[model samples]
Target chain A: MRKLGAITQRELLSLFCSPIAYIVIAGFWLVTGAITIWNADAFGPGKPATLRDIFMWTPFILTILVPAMSMRTLSEEYRSGTFETLMTAPVSDAQMVFGKYLASLIFYVIMLAGTLIYPLLMEVFGNPDWGEVLALYLGLVLLGIAFTAFSMFASSLTRDQAVAWILGAMPLMLLVLSVYSLVRRFEGWQREVVQQFNIMGRFGQFARGQVELDGVVFFLATAVLFLFLTVKVVESRRWR
Target chain B: MIEVRNLSKYFGKRCAVNGISFTVEPNTIVGFLGPNGAGKTTTIRILTGYMPPTSGTARVAGHDVVKESLAVRSVVGYLPEAVPLYPEMRVYEYLNFRGKLRGMDRPRREAAIARAVERCWLAEALTRPIGQLSRGYRQRVGLADALLHSPKVLILDEPTVGLDPTQVRETRALLRELAADHPILFSSHTLSEVEAICQRILIIHEGRIIASGTVDELKAQVGGQRRVIAELKGPQAEVTTAVQKLAGIVNVRATADGGWTRLDIAANNNAQNAVSELAAGRGWAVRELRQEVPSLEDFFVKAIVDARVRQAGAKEDRR
Candidate 1:
């Protein structure tokens, strides 16, 4: 665990030292805050502020923003040839992957946390349900974890961060699109399977404040699967 | 404290390191001398547990590199050819991070980082970011990182490649100082550096070890048949004919310049005595008679060419 932490600490140091991290954080907040304010005006003070539009826009914004934050996690190491120095150290492959994943997750969380003022503003000007707000934050955290893991995996696949960004964004876009797509031609069980696999379908329950155990498991499973794949990809570098 | 048995590495059917084997005893600095693409870096990578060999086995500090890679890595400090480092990190921060990765506690990490910085002469650069340092300082930082864990074995791949002459001399001095306790294996294409530092030298070519031994041993082996020049004030043809009959003499060539007989002899042993005796016997005035020993650079070049020629011959014979 200490070895993992060391790697994570180094990752965080590099992440913060570069200008890209600050740019991504500032860009995410500016876009998300603008969208939330416009949606707040549409909701108006007469209606109960449900933070629905903020949560609604989160998945799409995160789909792009998360990739920007994670594209350099492993790709920059490979590009700079520091991967050799790092891998040759006493740390194991699993520790390196997990440490980098944790660092990206923490950065994502920081950016996600920046949007909390929107919900707080709702509470001040209008009556807001605390339960729904908590669930929305939890779902956003889960979504961030999933995106961070997948982007890290994409970063491991190539040495080019731009290529990694594209690789990470394409799958997330398809995931969100598939959730709301109308599949009228599919049979009953097939349609059910497709809908159940949708990220928004699981995340939708959290937005509604239902707090379903299955949805929590689905998000965690997706994050874990992608993280595991990232480890395997890093280990395969020896073979290459 | 390092051993390899028939190790080989292939990158998609192209063999980067062929079946090469050698051992490094403790407290000795062994120089790996090779040309470009001679598998020096590849072998170091495998020994450091950065990559696994395609065949055979390697042991460092008595731990199998493939089976107990973490154990091998713990005992080995590696400085790669490119001097891989994070540009954003301060020198001390980088060393401390590496120490932690090697499982050193907080106090131990601090002590190790301090010692490494002192040893690598990086005290002034400790607070500066690595990317802003000069090339020589960056190389020193790499050495400092490799030394941070206080590892038993040091594998340095072309550590002095891009440094200036003074830096190269200082690095050689540092290696000599470190080799009193640690077994060091460093690769270099620079023959003079290897000669100045290493107690034992392994000359590699085409992913194979062409020659291995002490400096004099390699000179006597690959540099067979020594050369001696003799200039005398006598008849050129007569002196040449007379020197050809001397014992231990293989061949003699005579040239007359400025009314002096200059004879160049290829002989098995010190033909100096025989030439002098002949000059005294003939009662002729001698100008110069000196034996020339081939330099390590000459021996290295010859050995590599000889290995390539033999390899080509073997390939042709197989056909």
Candidate 2:
């Protein structure tokens, strides 16, 4: 618990010390607003404006913003060699991984929360489905957790932030591109395996107002899997 | 206290630290003397639980480094060669953060931070950003980080590497004071610093401890023979031939001045009477017969050279 607070405070302090949080949050909101306004059917004879449109743009924004945010999480420590201080502290690998993961997740949450202004704005203009808006925000939270964990795995790979950003972005890109193409190629179990790991495919159902247990499980499992891999990678470094 | 047994680390096929072992007692300042690429840093990292040995086991503070690592880490303070620090933070903030990492809270945390600043002499720079500080100030911050929790063991690595002379002396004084309470195992290529403070020394060469003993013992071991400079008055050939046939003489060289001879006596293996017997026989008047005192620097070079020569001989014998 103490290690958890220490890591969180240190990471938060670093985040606010520079312009990373401001730039990332602003970029997220600007891009998200532009995409939501373009996609919304507010001015046409279509469905009413809901947070669904706003949230539909979140994963797309997060796909880039998360990597930018998480690129330096562990990479900077490995590069600067302060990780020796972290490793030699009286903290378990689980604590270390979870602490760093939580800090990134909180950052994503703050960025996500800042975009709530769009939904609140839609509430006054149209009679938006509050239930659907709430569900959309729920889906956004889950997606953030999954993205944060996966990006942390990339951050653990190398000390260079550029490499970490590339590695973090690549998998999400593959997942997004994989579902549409790979799902069409296979017929049975192979297709099931391909789509199970497809983040965008699962997210598509939630955005379309469907809440499936399988989708939530997919996000949770994916988050836990990458976090476990990160912990293992960090622990293995002690021997070398 | 620390104990390492049959410790070795291999990267693929190349052994970085071959089966080397040594022990450090409590409250003693032990110097780890070695040149670059000698695996001194690797050994310190292993002891601090920042790395693990490929084989064998180590016990630090009565806890297994591999098994009870957290327990060991709780009592150990480590300063890596690079002194990892977040430059954006203020000196006081960094120390306070480090204190929290070590499990101290509130009153204890404040007290530890105060002590660390006082010990490192970082009081004036407490509110200054670490990036704005000079290299000397950065080093003091690193030391303050190590001292924050008041750990029982301190592991410092080439701490004075880039410091000026004055900073080096101040750090040396700080280490001397620190050694009275906590055991310190510091690695350095600076032989004079080691000679002045350390009660015991471990000479590392090519990932192995070639010699571990007092300064006098290592000097005698590495500087295998003692040389005597004699000023004599006589015919050089007669004096040389007389000394050549003597019992204890291993090698004799004539000095630039016609009558003097420099004798390299085989150290413990030879007796002193043999030189006197030859002098008595030749009736050469002796003026100076003083022993050359070998400094630690000379012994360090000699030890490394001797180890390489021995290794080469062993490789040849194997073939």
Q: What are the runs in model 1 whose C-alpha is more than 4 Å off?
A: A183-187, B230-247, B251-263, B271-289
Q: How many residue pairs clash in each candidate?
A: 0, 0
Output the number of the lDDT-best candidate. 1
* Candidate 1 displacement at residue B59 in angstroms: 0.6
lDDT of 1 by residue, B198-298 (tens): 99999888889888999888887855788999999898888888999999899898889877999899998879998999899999899998989789988
TM-score, chain B, each candidate? 0.88, 0.82
CAPRI class of candidate 2 = medium
**How close is every model to the real structure, measured as TM-score?**
0.93, 0.87
Question: Which stretches of candidate 2 lie above 4 Å from their native place?
Answer: A39-47, A181-198, B222-292
Best TM-score among the predictions, by candidate number? 1
- The DockQ assigned to candidate 2 is 0.62
